[model samples]
Target: MMRIGLILAGGQARRMGGIDKASAILNGRPLIHHVLERLAPQVDQVLISGRSDYGSGLTVLADRTDGPTGPAAGLHAAAKHLADVPDCGLITVPVDAPFLPLDLVERLCAGPLPAIAHAGGRMQPAFSAWTPVEVAAQLAHRPAGAGLALIQLARDANARTVAFENPGAFRNINSAEDLAAAEADVD
Candidate 1:
């Protein structure tokens, strides 16, 4: 099966003072660079879901629907955009998550249905692999802000959770402090 990486970069970044968390510097490189490096080779294509002006040379997709309805909107937009691809599954990752496992795509695709990472006793929904068909179906039927968390969407689609021992593998740089801590951990 073919897999495509969807890097979610549509957040308002209110917690980080309205800055683009994906462009934030970590170890002298943008956080998105780390995510791209880890995911690019594993997937057939990597698309950034959000603003088109973040950078060039990347397939940037703007959300068709308006307003911030959380990551769900971004996922729906990406699924819709890539709906034509045959046998394509989306491996979603937040742009702020720079320490994603290198084998994330492989591990998520090892199962038949969508699979998300289980770390620190929490399901990291953003780091999930979902078939475009399944996601598109949900997008069509689900109501807006119906408390449909990404995990719920995965479960309704009969998705499974892939457990990873290292919680650090899912650390997200949401704030300046989080970025510093992630850098320190890498050091």
Candidate 2:
């Protein structure tokens, strides 16, 4: 089964002073580059969901009215874009999560069809895999709770929780300190 990788870079980033999280540098490279490198290999194709232009050489799906703001919107955009292709499994990862595990796709895909990544006892909804019918039936609805709702949807559907040992790999680089910490790991 081919997975369509959707980079969830559409967050407002109010915590990061509204700066584009994807462009934030980690290990001397834009976070998106790191995420893309790890993700592109696992999935058949990649789509970046955000308004900011990163020139990442991947399709950037612009935000639309179909979904609410933030991470939910990104998922909605990907689902809508792939609506024509039936049975497409959508794999989503947040742009701020630069240190995503190498086996993220495999682990998520290995689980139930619409599984989500779980680490540090947290349901990382952005790091998830969903089928087209699943998306249309579940995620296509309006976003009332944003990312959290997606996780709940996965849980409601009984999607497997694929856990990773390294919780740090899911660290969110939303600030200078976070970026510095990630940099230290690389250095």
Candidate 3:
């Protein structure tokens, strides 16, 4: 199946003072740039799940009122965007996660149809791979008002947890402190 990557960049980022997390600079570059650099080579195509145009020329799949809210909404938008594409799967990683592993797509695809990254004994639902059809179907059953959590959707789909060794590779920039740490790590 053709694999497409989606960067979940639609968070409120309240911790980051309402700034778009994707545009937040880390090591003198936008966080999305870092994510794309690591994720682009691993998948056939990349899509951003946010309203803002980061000037990266990526197709931004914005959340829809028809779908559940939160991170799952981003997945829903992506699934709808790929509705015409047959026999394709989607691998998603958060835009804030600048240090995503290069082998993320490979590892997730190696497992079941729906697989989520598990590092440091915690499930990283945003860092997951899914069959777009299955994800859409599961999402349709969710309540659109409160918004379904990505973790709950993963559990409902019986997503396999693909264990990864390096927990740092999944580190995400949620605040200024996290960005500073990431900057230091890069330096």
Candidate 4:
């Protein structure tokens, strides 16, 4: 399947002290670098959903609607990007999670048409995939504020829930402690 990947970085970053999570340092490199390095090879193209340029040389998308929601904003923008790519799929990963699986897109694409990462007995909704056409059609009905709307959309599409063996891969760096822990994971 044709794949389009989006790094959802348009967060308010309240938990991380209002700093851009993608800019957060990990192992002396920006978290965006780590994420892009792992995710780029898994998809045909990569777009960053952020207010400012991530300085990673990838296209950046911002919330177009008047009242910006949260993750949904990025979701909308990414889905809209599908207008140019016919019959393609969109895979979204949060910018805060630098340790995403190298096979994330591969594993997600192996499941259902619209799928999500289920680890640690919880649904990692942000780490998901969707059919751009279907999501764009029903996206209007979904509240912009519903960050987990993709999970709901996945279920609505009868998506296959893929269980990841490595739960640590889904860890999100939401705080300084989380960043420190991720750094330690490397050394």
Candidate 5:
């Protein structure tokens, strides 16, 4: 089965003064660069769910206008791309998570068809592996007023929660202070 990586980078970064989080600098490189460096080797192809490529050379999928907004829209766009594809699965991660685990895909794939990382006693919905066929089916059958929340989708899919030991590995850079702290941790 082919494993594809999808980096969710379309967020407005409202907490970071409305800047593009993907382009934000971290340890001398753009945040997306760090995410790509970690995720590239784990998948066959990588796609960015954002407005711009951010110079990553991978295909950038824009969120669907008709779907519920936020990260779910990005996932919706990805699901559309994977609709006709065969034997392929999507592993998603937030662009701001520069410290993503190196074995994320392998670990997530170890669980059910649709599994999400569970760390810090919470479901990290952005860090998940999804079966495209299942995702498409779920999206199609979504009821009216269900809203475009990924966590809700995960619950409806009965997504397995793969517990991860290192919660810090899932740190998200949502603010300048968070970015500074992450920078301090980078070697």
Candidate 6:
């Protein structure tokens, strides 16, 4: 099945002083570049889900709601935007996670159901595969403040977790300290 990569770039980033994490520099390249690189080869196309003000080369799907309410809204928006596409799944990732595994798409698509990365015994919901129609239907009935909970959605959808030995594959850069740690790991 064809897969579309969705980069969730709508977070408030309060910890990063309201800066756009996707545009942050890591190892001399914008973090989003790393995400796109990993996602590009794995999917037919890529879309960045965020506010319209944040112009990016990739297709942008603006969240119709406000705040970091949750990733669910962005996921919902992406699903709705790509509703026309048939037989495609969405591989969603956070823009701040520059170290996402190269095999992320493959591993996610290997399952019969929606799948996520379970690295270091933690379920990384942001890095999972989703079907737009299925996800959008779930979003329509999801309770308020429930949109950000990917784990719950996955469980409800009977999604499976793809365990990986490499914890670095899911490492995310949320603060300057996290960025430092990621940089050190890269070295």
lDDT of each candidate versus the true structure: 0.82, 0.79, 0.90, 0.81, 0.89, 0.80
lDDT of 6 by residue, 20-138 (tens): 78877778877788777778888898888876424456778877553225787788878788889888889999999887888889988987647877998899989989888878766
Tell me the deviation in Å of residue 101 in model 3: 0.5
TM-score of each: 0.92, 0.89, 0.97, 0.91, 0.95, 0.90
| Candidate 3: clashing residue pairs, number | 0
Q: After superposition, how far is residue 59 of candidate 3 from its true place, in Å?
A: 0.5
Worst 10 residues of 6 by lDDT: 62-71
Please list all clashing residue pairs in model 2, or write none if there are none: none
Q: In candidate 3, how many Å is residue 34 off? A: 0.2
**Which RMSD values do the candidates have, in order?**
2.0, 2.2, 1.1, 2.1, 1.5, 2.4
For candidate 4, the TM-score is 0.91
Candidates 1 and 5, the one with greater TM-score: 5
Sort every candidate by lDDT, greatest first. 3, 5, 1, 4, 6, 2
Ranking by TM-score: 3, 5, 1, 4, 6, 2
Error of 5 at 48 (Å): 0.4
Best by TM-score: 3
Question: Model 2, range 66-118, lDDT digits (tens) per residue?
Answer: 56556666777777888888657789888888778988988888856888888
lDDT of 4 by residue, 52-94 (tens): 6677778888887632267767878887877777878789998
Q: lDDT, candidate 1, residue 94?
A: 92
State the lDDT of candidate 5 residue by residue for 1-187, as single tens digits: 8999999999989999998999999989999999999999999999999989998788999877555677877888898888888988899999999999999999988757799899999989999989888877778855433457788888889998899999999999999999988888875
* Model 3 regions lying over 4 Å from their true place: none
76-101 per-residue lDDT for model 3 (tens digits): 98999899899888999999998899
Residues forming the 10-long window of minimal summed lDDT in candidate 1: 63-72
- Candidate 5 residues lying further than 4 Å off, grouped into runs, are 143-146
Q: Residue 111 error for model 4, in Å? A: 3.8
